[model samples]
Target: MLDDEARRALSRWTVGEPNAIREYAHGAINQTWLIETARGSYAFRRCAQGGAEVVRQNHRLIGEAVARGVPTVAPVVVEDGNTVVVESGRVYALFPFAAGVQVDRDRLSNNDIQAMGRSLADVLEALRGCDRSLVKEGRYEVCVSEAIREIDRLLSVISELPPGEPSDENALERLTTRRAWLVEHGVEDGDPFADFDRQPIHGEFQDRNLFLGDGKVSCIIDWDNASWSPPEWEVAPFLDFVAAYDKVKVAAFLAGYRARCKLPDERLDACVWAYGLYRAHDLWLFREVYDRRNDKARRFLTPGRFKPHFERWLRR
Candidate 1:
């Protein structure tokens, strides 16, 4: 529920009187509320992690993206000529409600996937042209020792927990399998993308962040994770999304992206490997479910979600 101080802060903008406010059930990090007002509906979000400066930086990137014809929701400016408001030690921002539906990965058609590919390329290219000074250099490499330690800690914790739901068993099995795989084949020596160029990329460009309508992408939301990284790092996830490693779908997505930006053929394999390693080392879902006991993160866990990426990496 929204507090009084936060509600009062809405008056600083000309979005009109709020009639209804409901918090969105999804999202792992930020607290987002749908506010229906007299003038129009808007999305009010509280920065759960970074402070006002982060919000301001995101707005600058979004502004640059909009100028380049990217389909994304821009933040609404308040009376004081700012896109963010700080009230009660919290950072908040408002955006006009984006009209579209979020489609799951399984339901997406080839056309939809191609549209997503094109949109993501546009976003990456737009951000690439922005002043590089706006963002800090993002990490493309991972520490194998730290990942091994974390996996060991998680395995120990899971072993001690009382017998619980089927999901707990699922987590235990998956973690054990991952531990063995990591031990045998984890990158320990060289930098992953030492030769590739880095640019601003939407770090999290998965299906959930995209909105679709009439089989086309209407908007690309959620810019909080935007940062500077190799362009292939952004394209790797889409390659994984193509069902059964279908070459046609992969070609369509690559063609769409190539129309807007350049992706060398030689770099394709490396891109896939980069994304594979990322998923291999990622333990956030486990930490959230087993450590923090967050129910929302549990939905992301599926049988063998991490194994496919590892297998892909092995094949490459």
Candidate 2:
């Protein structure tokens, strides 16, 4: 349900009363709302603080993708011809609602994985030259150094924490353990593919972000972290995500991906190891920071969850 201020803020974007302002409580960062009006239903999202520029760039990029016949839930232009609307110092964007269901791991078959792969390849191709202004931090370039410094900072905080706060101490210990694991695995080593082919990738191209309708991908949503990256950087993560459930399904996905786009064999091998380390580092960061702040963050922190996943993939 929406409060009075939220109702007023949303009314500016729609022609009629903003009825059915139901919250879509899936994402961790943004506040999403499903709104219905006399005109049409829309997915309205209040972006996180300091995300206005990212939203603007996404609006531009998604619009370009739609022009190229890609299936994307692009943001709608308000009365002022702006995709983003700032009201009460908060930035919001209204997207034309895509009627589809998000596929879960249990429901994902080889064919579904193939469809996902094909659609993602099409999206990556369509996103070329959309925007060159905002560059997302590449995993190999920043993730390790940043995660290392953050772990040290968190350990300091844990030391200062009042004694007998066993839960806090445990969480911080987990963080340190992950940091050591990453360092032992040579995460801070120099990048092998420093000059790899780079382009804009759907930063969070995973199952939850894809919308399926009529046995096909209807739309790709949430372009918050769209930025320049290597094909392997994005492809490896998507493969890792699907492979977590079943390896056979991942092979089908790779077949579909290769049919549409050429993923260099060497790049894929190196990037998988790089991304595995990055995921290991990132999951621990999520655990340390959000342990007390939000319980949902625990889902990413299941006691060295990505350890074996990284170890196996990196060694291969």
Best by TM-score: 1
Q: What is the per-residue lDDT of model 2 for residues 26-73, given as tens digits with 9 covering 90 to 100?
A: 776678998888888888888873566767877787777778888887
Q: Cα lDDT of model 1 overall? A: 0.78
- Cα RMSD (angstroms) for every candidate in the order listed: 2.7, 3.3
Which residues of candidate 1, in runs, are more than 4 Å off? 1-6, 213-216, 241-248, 291-293, 305-310, 313-316
lDDT of 1 by residue, 38-84 (tens): 89999898877588987898889888878877788899999889999
Model 1, 185: alpha-carbon shift in Å? 1.2
**What's the C-alpha lDDT at position 79 in model 1?**
86
| Model 1 Cα shift for residue 91 (angstroms) | 2.0
